[model samples]
Target: MFDTIRRYTARLRTSERAQPQGTVERRAHNLFEAAAVYVAARVEDDQDRIEEAAAWVSPEALSFGVSELACRAVVALARERDESPGAVARDLLGLPAA
Candidate 1:
């Protein structure tokens, strides 16, 4: 049992390490996704994506007003861009804001 567990754990770690890093790693990304989800959730606009995104946001990231605004901005941009909310959120977050 111990040997099996160790082998699986190693494989999991290796698989995770091989994955490309994305916007979810950034504090800004967390904030953007959280806010977008909260707003989208209330309106039932895109609950599936929002719920998935909400899992990645932390309280520490949501504490800032700037982050909240960024989230709202992402949702708005998602609408205007006619893109998936999650994808738009990631795009906005990946770029340095002007």
Candidate 2:
């Protein structure tokens, strides 16, 4: 899983770097995608990929992306485990069940 996340993030970075100067809108979209990739790396516990992804976007943008990913992940895990989203999130983070 970690290897996969690393490879995916590397590809994203490479593609972004290869692109010529893009419009503000396109850059913003890329940043969001980068953030999502960062979140995936985090979920996979891949520190290297997380750092690589972080370098692709601003700290603020990455934070927002991570928050968005966390919410979505919680919902999905909740459904899979037949538990509340809050519970799933807490459990995933090793927190006491809420």
lDDT (CA) per prediction: 0.68, 0.81
Model 2, residue 67: what's the lDDT? 80
The worst-scoring run of ten residues by lDDT in candidate 2 lies at 21-30
TM-score against native, each model: 0.30, 0.56
Candidate 1, 1-98: lDDT as tens digits: 99999999999999867767663544445566576566666568776865665666666654463466766777888889998778886665695333
- Model 2, 11-91: lDDT tens digits are 999986776666443433456687788877877999999888898888888888778877887898899999998888788
Candidate 2 deviant stretches above 4 angstroms = 1-29, 43-48
The per-residue C-alpha lDDT of model 2 at residue 89 equals 76
Candidate 1 stretches greater than 4 Å from native: 1-63, 94-98
RMSD of 2: 14.5
